[model samples]
Target: MSPDFLLLYVNDPDASAGFYGKLLDRAPLDARPGFVMFKLDSGMRLGLWGTETVKPAPNAPGGFEIGWPVGSDADVDQMADDWAARGISIIQQPETMGFGRTFTALDPDGHRLRVYQPALRP
Candidate 1:
């Protein structure tokens, strides 16, 4: 089965909405004191919530993160450069690994996101 949705726990909903909205170029579909929802154009859903509202995964960093599989290595490189230019922190540069081309970046709250393109098509 395909992954259906993702939720991110944050300390501040407004700040997270501002950060994500600007990055995603869209406003949240649902907004509340403790939660926000962004309907990603990629057909997935992202839910943001206050830390107090949900239980964290055991030993997890307890935050939100997102990654998109790009079309090619060039796309990955361009995306990394573009995000870096926007002042987003690049935790890892695009590089070839066993998994294929990949890079890692962090959102405002220090959540880790890894973007990867597979080496071989399914």
Candidate 2:
């Protein structure tokens, strides 16, 4: 069996759509007033729907945010620059942890998303 895609529900579709659009450099697919979808290169679809309509899975606190993995610290820097330029809130500046470098951003519904990748392979 194979896994399908994931969809997130947000309080504001326009803000969520705009955020993902700038981040992904493309407009959402199958967009409607109440929903939008991002078709990632990984064949996984990230979708946004009206918050009031979502039914969270058991054992889940609503739905957790998504992430984008970059290749290096430089890439993380560039991502933060781009996101800031687009007026998206960068909750945390890029910083190196024991495992890697990362930055967090809050989406429309206040979900925190972190983008990161391995610092080095041990």
Candidate 3:
């Protein structure tokens, strides 16, 4: 099966699209009142669909998180700050963990967005 796409159920596709467009620094590949899709640098497609429009509406909100890996701890910190400056809510501050330094933020629709820096291995 293919693993190149992810769809997020949103309360309002247009608002979600605007929020993500600014966050990602790009426009959607396709956008309508009910849906929006974005092609990331990794070639993965991220879609935002109106919750009420989905065939099987999401059972509930926030069962998953989308993660972004950066080159280093500094980068993770920088992203967290950047996102906060843009009005994104930083739910978790940057902190080092087994994997690396990381921070978590909430998207307009309350989806968890995480940025991390992988710990180096010997």
Q: Which of the numbered candidates is closest to the native, going by highest TM-score?
A: 3
lDDT of 1: 0.80
| Candidate 3 residue-wise lDDT, 17-120, digit = tens | 99999989999999877999999999999999888899876865555699999998999999988889998999999999998899999987788999999899
- Write model 1 residue lDDT over 2-26, tens digit each, in one string: 9966877777778878888988899
Q: What's the TM-score of each model vs. the native?
A: 0.83, 0.83, 0.95
Model 2 lDDT per residue over 42-107, tens place: 988888887655665223223476778898898988988887887778889999998799998777
Candidate ordering by TM-score (highest first): 3, 1, 2
Candidate of highest lDDT: 3
Residue 116 lDDT, candidate 3, scale 0-100: 94
Tell me the spans in candidate 2 whose CA falls farther than 4 Å from its real position.
Answer: 55-63
List of clashing residue pairs for candidate 1: none
**lDDT, model 2:** 0.79
The lDDT values for all models are 0.80, 0.79, 0.90
Q: Order of candidates by lDDT, top first?
A: 3, 1, 2
On TM-score, the stronger of 2 and 3 is: 3
